[model samples]
Target: MRADRLVSLVLLLRQRGRLSAATLAHELEVSTRTVLRDIEALSAAGVPVYAERGRHGGFALLPGFRTELTGLNHDEALSLLVAGLGRGEQVFGLGSALASAMRKVVDALPEGSQATASDAARRMLIEPETDLLARRAAVDEVPGDVAAEVRRAVFAGHKLRLHYAAAGRPPAWRTVDPIGLVTVRDRGYLLATRSGEDRTYRLSRVLAAEELPEPAERPDHVDLDRIWRDRSTRFRAGGDQVAVELRLRPSRREELAGTALAVLAEAAEADGVGGAGGADGADGADGAGGWLRMTVTFQDARHAEWALWQLATDAEALAPPSLRTALRDRALALAARYDTPP
Candidate 1:
C-alpha cells in the first residue's frame, strides 16, 4: 500500500507539474508528515523531485519527467472514468482510491487524447451529484472503518462478527459468513449467511463489525450476481404477499404500478377490466369512469394501504377487506382530526 501511495504521489506530481504538500496530503488522505517522508524517499530513490519555498511553490518533479504508467487508449480511459462518475465508490469505502486511479487513467492517455477526453467527460452527466426533488439526496452514512472490515471479510473469505440494529428489534451481535458487498443508489449492503441461512444487512445499520480470523463457511466458488438474485427473489416472496384489486384513472396507472411491489394482473377492457383481490383471486369491478382495473401484489396490507393512501380519491381499492378497512380507518382518522374543533 505504501508503494502504491508513492506511485500515486509521483503521478500527482507528473500530472499537475507542482502541488503543495498540503494539497498532496489532502489528495492522498495522509498527513503532511507522511508526504514529506515520501518526498525524501522518492528523492533518495533517484527520482528527480525537488521542493521550493513560496506561497505558490511546493514539490515538483524534474522538467519533462513522466512515468511510463499503464497504457490506456483514449476510449478505454474515457470509459473507465465514466464508469465511476458517481458516488457509488463511496458505498464501498473506496472514493479516494478511485479518484486517484481515475486521475492516473486520464494522465496515462496520449497527450492529444487527454484534453479531448476530459472535455467530453465534462459534458456527460452520470448520477448528477444533486437531486432535483430534494436538497440533494442524503448520503447513506456507513462508518468507514466498519465498511472496511466488512469488505476485508468478504474478500478474504472470512467470517464476520456484526453488531446490527434490525428495525423493531434490539441491537444484537451476529456472526455471519460474508458473501459479498453491494451498493445501490449509494446504499451499501453486506450479503452473508448465518448457519447456512441467507442474511443481508444494510451497511448503514451496522453498529460495529469485526473480521473473524476463522475461514468462512461458504461455497468454494461464489457467483455474487447469482447469489444476490436468488436472495432477492426469496426476500421479495418471504413477506405477507398481500394482493389487492384497484380501479384508478388511466392517468394514474404509472404511479400505482410504480408503488405496488408487483402486478399480479392488469387489463383495460373497453371501459374497465375484470379483477381478483382475495386469497382465492376472485374480484369484480363494473367499468367506473373509464377506469382500469388492476390486481396488484403488495409486500403486505400495510404496504397496500400506504400506497393507496397516496393516490387519495384518484384510486379506489376494490376488494380485500383488510386493505379496504385499513384505508377506511385511516380516512376516518383524518376526517376526525380535521373535523375536531381546535
Candidate 2:
C-alpha cells in the first residue's frame, strides 16, 4: 500500500507540480495524516520532494528533478511511436503539436531507441483508396476547428450554441446540449439533443459554436455503439426493407469479412460459389468462384441508390425492381457523362 501511494504521489507531483495536503488526501481518498506520511516516504526515497509552511504552502518536487523513463527498451519505444503516427491528424488534432511532443519524447529515449523508432516510422504508411464522392461529402460535412471544439465540449459536458447549416436551407443558430462526437468513416458527427429531440449534426456543416454557461447533463446508460448500429433505420422513413443478394469474389469476401456488414451473417461455400447471408437476403447467383450472397435493409429506393454507389462494381443488387432500376439508371447516366468528349 505504501509503494502504491508513493508511485501515485510521484505521478501527481509530475502532472500538477504541487498538491496541498487536503487536495492530496481527497485525491487519494485517505486522511491528511496518511498523505503527510506518504510525502515523507517519497522524500526518504531520494525523490527530491519537500513542503513549505504558511498560507501558500504545499508539497512539491525540487526544481529540475526529472522522471526519466529509462525502463523502456528500444523495441517498446519504436512500437509506441509507430502506433501514434498511424492514428493520423484527426485523432490527435492538426498542426505540429503532436509531432513536436513526440519529438521531445523520442529525443529523451536511449540513443539506439530513437533510430529504431525513426526506422519504424519510415516503414509504416497508411493509404486508403480515394473515393471522390465520399471525400467531397466528408469535406463538405464539417470544418476541422468546429469539430475539435464540439469534441472538447462533448467531453467537458458543456452546452454549445452552434450556427449550423441544415440540409437544403440557410444556416440557423441554435443551442444544443452536446452529447457525443461520432467519427463515422471520414465524417465527423455530433449527437446532441435539441428541443428535447435527439439529433445528429455534421460537424462540417457547423458555421460557429460558442460555449454555454450551463453544462449539459449526459443521459444515463446511453449506448453510442448501439445508436450508430441503428443509424440507417433511425434516420429513414417508411421504406420497405429489401433483401438484395451479392456474389463477392473470394478476395472481396475476405475484405468484407473485416467490415461491419459482415458480422450480420455467415458466408458459406455452395456449388463452387460462396454463399453469405445478410438480413434481407434477396435471391440471385452468378458463376463467380468466390462470390457471396448477403442482404441489407434499405429504407427506400433512395437509400438503396446511396448503398449502390458505395458498393460500386464490387457487389450487385438483385432484388426490389425499383432499386435495380435506380442503380441501372445511375450507372447509365455516369457512363453517358464519361462517354461525352470533353
Candidate 3:
C-alpha cells in the first residue's frame, strides 16, 4: 500500500506540476513529516526530486521530468505495460508504435524488475469474449477522426452539418446543434437538436460530419439527463403493462432479481408439473418445485415475446389475454415465413 501511495504521489505531482509538502500529505492521507521523508527517498533513488522554500515553498520535479519505470520493482513495471496495451488498438494507432512504446518501457525496467515483469505478463492474459469482440470490432470500424471532431464540436457548442443514415433509411444531409456524445455498451451516439427538436444519431451511421462556420449561441441550460429519461419513457410506451407469472428455477430466480422488468409478488414451492402451479394453497415441499409470481410490465407484445424467448421453457406469462394472443400471432407469422415454399 505504501508503494502504491508513493507511485500515486509521483504521478499526481507529474500531472499537477508541483505540490507543497502539506498539500501532498493531505492528498496522500499521510503526515507532512512522512511526505518529506518519502520525497527524500525519491530523490535518493535518483528521481530528480527537489524542494523550494519560503512564501512559494513546495516540492517539484524539474520541468518535463517523468518517473522512469526503471525504478519499479519487476511486478509493477510489467503490470503497467500490460494495462496500457489492453486499451485495444485505438490508442497508439495501428502498427508498431504501440509495440515500440511497450518495448521501451519494459527495456527501461531494472534487471530484477524486468524478469518479474516478464513473469507477471506471462501469467496474466486477457481473452475477449467472442460476441463482445464482434461488437467492439463493429464500433472500431466507425471513423474515429469524425467521432473526435463531433465530440469537439459538442463540447464547444458548435453547430454541425453532416450526412447521416438511419436504420432502413437512405442517407440524408442535415444541420444540427451538437449537444453531447453518449456511449452505450459498444456503440457511440450523438445527441443533438434538429429543427428545435432533440434526436440521437448513431455514430456508426454518420457518413460525414463537419463543424459549420456559423457559430450558434450556446444554450443557457442543457438538461441531458432529462432528455435521456424522456427518450427511454417514449421507447417504453410501445407496449402496455401485462401481468406475467413465472416459475423460476433456483438459479433463474436469482437471475430475475437483476432483471429490470421482473417484479416479485409472491414466492412458493415449485409445483411438480414444471409448467402448472397450484393456486394459493400449495405446500413448499415439492423439492426444487417452487413457483414465483411476478408482474412484468411490457412496453409492447414484442417485448413480452422477446422476454419469453430469452427465458425459454423455464418461465410463463399468466395474464392479459392480449399478450398471449399477440405472442401466438407472432409465432404463427414467423412459422409461415419459415414454412413458405422456397
TM-score of each: 0.77, 0.54, 0.51
- For candidate 3, write residues 115-224 as lDDT tens digits: 68867877975535345446533333467567656755775778898899987899999999887665544456677888878678888788888887666445757787
Report lDDT per candidate.
Answer: 0.79, 0.62, 0.63
Q: For candidate 1, what is the lDDT?
A: 0.79
Error of 2 at 183 (Å): 1.6
* Poorest 10 consecutive residues by lDDT, candidate 1: 278-287
Would you list the clashing residue pairs of candidate 1? Answer: none
* Better candidate by lDDT, 1 or 3: 1
Q: What lDDT tens digits, residue by residue, belong to model 2 across residues 168-263?
A: 999999998887756555456778888777778877778888777788866855788887667645664334544455544454555444432323
Ranking of candidates on lDDT, top first: 1, 3, 2
Order of the predicted models by TM-score, top scorer first: 1, 2, 3
* Deviation in Å, model 3, residue 15 alpha carbon: 24
